[model samples]
Target: MNTTFGGKPHVLILGGGSVGLTTASELRKTLGTEVAITIVDPRPYMTYAPFLPEVGAGSIDPRNVLAPLRKILPGTKVVTGGVSAIRSADNTVVVTTEDGAQLEIAYDYLVVGLGAVPRLLPIPGLAENAIGFKQVEEAITVRDKILANLAEAASTKDPKVRKRLLTFTYIGGGFAGGEAVTEAEDMVRDALRYYPDLHASDIRFVLIDAAPFVFPELTEDQRAYVLNQLRERGIEVKLETFLNSAENGVIKTSDGDEFETDLLVWNAGVKPNPILMDEESSDLPVVTERGPLMGKLDTLADLRVNGAEGPIDNVFAGGDCAAVPDLASGEGKFCPPNAQHATRQGKRIADNVARSVQGRPLVDYYHKNLGVMATLGMYKGVGRLMLGDKEIDVRGLPAWAMARAYHVYAMPTLGRKAAVLAGWASNLVSRRDIIGIPQSADPRAAFELAANSGPKKK
Candidate 1:
């Protein structure tokens, strides 16, 4: 609204993740300087999820994986806040800004691209003890916590304390889950080589999941290979297991096992944004059965908001938040929330939005399924690449390169690409830093103690 647009329509984009930013990028090219665009997200940046494993491994710098929303969108307005409520009927959004101030924003169009959150279950103490691999900060913190555990173990001579400090349990065997587990384990084991007091066996890295195999997209053979490789490294893989509870580093599983550990990484699954997905309470037009958008739009073939009959006017959705029909699946399945589809959906969303506003013929979105890829660690990975009619199964170095190449090629902004590339190149030669900063369990220990203290105790 502050920018000079000469009465041109304003577009409000919710969330600054892959879909929202992509929509903004494409919109800039499609609508030019005529239209006003505003993007709202709780954080100021977008965390490139694919590189999170490397971040946890200390292979890539954390700064490189985050893309600042305002920095990327030069002329567009970037609101740093969470969307508390969407007044669709009034074309207004209630946003809680970064400084905690509330603002009511009016828009001619609304784009719902609020990405998903980690799908958490009501397992006891799971919420308090387990950390996820969703954001840049979480990834970096995991790395730091692992390194800190090593330092803690090294500083102590007690075997029980050292074992508890060194044990790490990861839940989930999906792409993010596997990548985070393997990559972090690799880094930790390599760090063990430097410690005179520690052996690789001293560090227990256990991966627990409800699935019998890892990497859902990979062939059975590939999954077996991954399994074998992990076992060969002395990593514990527990399958078809349910996590019962976790508290004070003690993990109780459904498989009649008890483990004490200092860390737990939960990558079970992700649900759509909680507030938006709440059908009973939320005003957001989310389909009850569809769950939280999960990064796709409930749109027509042309990416317009789907009404009971046809496209609705002025409303749109895209990214992991939309239940977009997967044309590639051909089974009436929605597109799985992934980078490839979200990136493609963003462009089409922008184009369709422009066309709708201009009273022009809309373009439908249809994309063939691009095969999936996952990296285990540096120089280790598995991928299914689809090129024309040839389907390629890549493993080891080739798969690693393929994964890196695709991610770097897809990573937004030349600066971010360069940063990741430089960090990776540096990683090949530089020694991994073992320093870890401790995260306090009590966030306000000093404040509480101070308030309780009056002069000196008698």
Candidate 2:
């Protein structure tokens, strides 16, 4: 180990999502010049997730929503690679680069903010038939696919083929599924003007969830309003219904019902990023109740990972990867994996890391609930805001405006936010760009074709 700490302990943060970036920034601010900081991840930028729906709808350029790490984090050392292994015994981590190069990084304090990935279930044909709704590329790809399906349906005269192309199904009713379906539905409805033969009525939209509600974030009254609104728009809201199989655009529901569709969106749920449970963490610390370190609250703090007994030092964890308890609710349920909580916890983790280095007292994290909002379609939305003791529900354009305003402020930077707003304005004034960039189906076929080609004779 290089002992050139210069009396400053080195801090290493994993992942580059909202939580990781926020924590890094906070640590830099609180530690003054005493701490050396480094952040590692495969990507060099953090994506502003709330604007993802707008990106899918082409109302915002995807580039505007992602903040490059080198740009946003000027002082922190940003390493672009994956943390391949964690050697906890020696307090060192192994990171692998895209070119097969690897390095061992030593840290006095380590924060694991590796965010969650989409949960893949063991259902047959799902890996091939369904597409996930996370990530910027998925949003753009879905937009292109939806528009392409529309074009194909309009050109085909066969009723069965057209129906198959126009049908779309989403398998989860959470925030991701709700936003994806709503934004896609709204854009397709508007783009129908280009296809004179296909109207909104010709398209089929189905939202299926095993749970009995659409948005778990909404109040009972607000949830009911959302359900009724979706029904009024002629979209099927199938609750308590789980998809058994989707083969060749045909889906079997839990109720033994079957349907044929072109699009299948899987937003069911997310598990901890597998990297968290790797060999690096074989003897890593965990939060537990009634331990020697911090008490029951130790396991529930923002960054500190308590052992089977209590708080463990030199390591921290947060975001969707850690099961941080919600103090607001007396129940022991872990905080739901949402952008709101992750962002907040990230800041707290940074502050705590800085404080520990300075030998200062660390603080506990407690937050009140912020209401949830969702857009149904063009000018329609629902919001459930928590007041002192009760919840207030609103719908229609007001809710839509609220949603837009909240996201505008929540965007990473002012400049990017302005660019997104400009895109929205431009979209309102002109036709939607629905062009698809075709990619080669068989990448290796190019090499084969090149090898087979002979020189042309003059």
Candidate 3:
């Protein structure tokens, strides 16, 4: 470790997600002005991921889910780029900036919270057509795309074409997929109320999952309740089913069913950041087929990366990128890759890093997961709550309220929290905005093209 720091003991964090920002916040508190902290991420803000479903549903404004890193982490030097490589051999990181420039940063301490990317399968047409359940842009694009379908449906006369435009398919039964389908269903239903031609029955929401149950995290009762709740609203719940192919706007399932649709949400799961497995990050010896591993950087209980001889001396990692052992769980169990675990782990790792720098004994991280919840759109939801020594299942409005309240509390800054609350409050009185705005995706195509062409120069 760099003992002599003229207030510049560089601490480089590889992500800007929940874990990355939390680590920066805690490190500031623990290290004070002793070390220089820098965080590099592809995005300028830390997305409040739990609100992604609401964003897609148009229940929350897109900006509400984004907490600007500059505004949130004041003392930290935030780099708008992705870490292309993490070479632990000499404590150096290669960052590919947003402008396509490469910058190498030498760090005395490293925190690899690179986070996860969507797990996409080799399903036909999925790569070219389907939208992901991650990222703010994905949520926005989904909202626009679904609305665009409605616009097309509203203007069409042919039954088949209308049906094709209105048909929606979601592949995956996890929280992302569950929440997305439900929210989209809700949004489209709301939209149909205002459309003169499109009837409620015209829109078909199909949720297909390979698993028997939609949410594996939910209790049997909760799962049954959600399934029934969705079906009651005309949403099709097809379990033990797989999407065989989604090619050329034709969606074919393994159940010998085929349909044409413009929308398909792929939210199967996520693998750890591919950067860990890339040639740039090869020197760390901290990667596996598992993507993220605790022993990769060979981290000790105190968060210091352990090498063959002893502590690698400076590098530390957590979040979805590390396999930190879950001290609260039973023997040989690692923390689950979730916001709850990652947030706590990030803070713990940060504090330990500060202590390690100060030549003090480091402490191990331990935190029992308080609960897990998934919103089912509007006043419906499901969750497992941990109270005292007992764990209880909640559903319906109560579950919805609990989930919203927790997410609001956890949403980064007070400004963002207030913005989200305001959006929700407004939603209660006014109907959802159903205008199709796919141009938001490109944002500048029209303007750029117009500018390129001489503007009334005659």
Candidate 3 runs further than 4 Å off: 1-7, 286-300, 306-311, 443-458
- Write candidate 2's Cα lDDT for 262-311 as tens digits: 88888897766665555444356533333222111224565587666566
How would you encode candidate 3's per-residue C-alpha lDDT over 295-316 as one tens digit per residue? 2344466666666667776777
Candidate 3 TM-score, true structure as reference: 0.93
Q: Please, what is the whole-model Cα lDDT of each candidate in the order they appear?
A: 0.83, 0.78, 0.83
TM-score of each: 0.92, 0.90, 0.93
What is every candidate's alpha-carbon RMSD to the true fold?
Answer: 3.3, 3.9, 2.7
- Candidate 2 lDDT score at position 72: 78
Error of 3 at 304 (Å): 3.7
| Model 3 lDDT, residue 318, Cα | 75
Who wins the TM-score comparison? 3
Backbone N/Cα/C clashes per model:
11, 2, 4
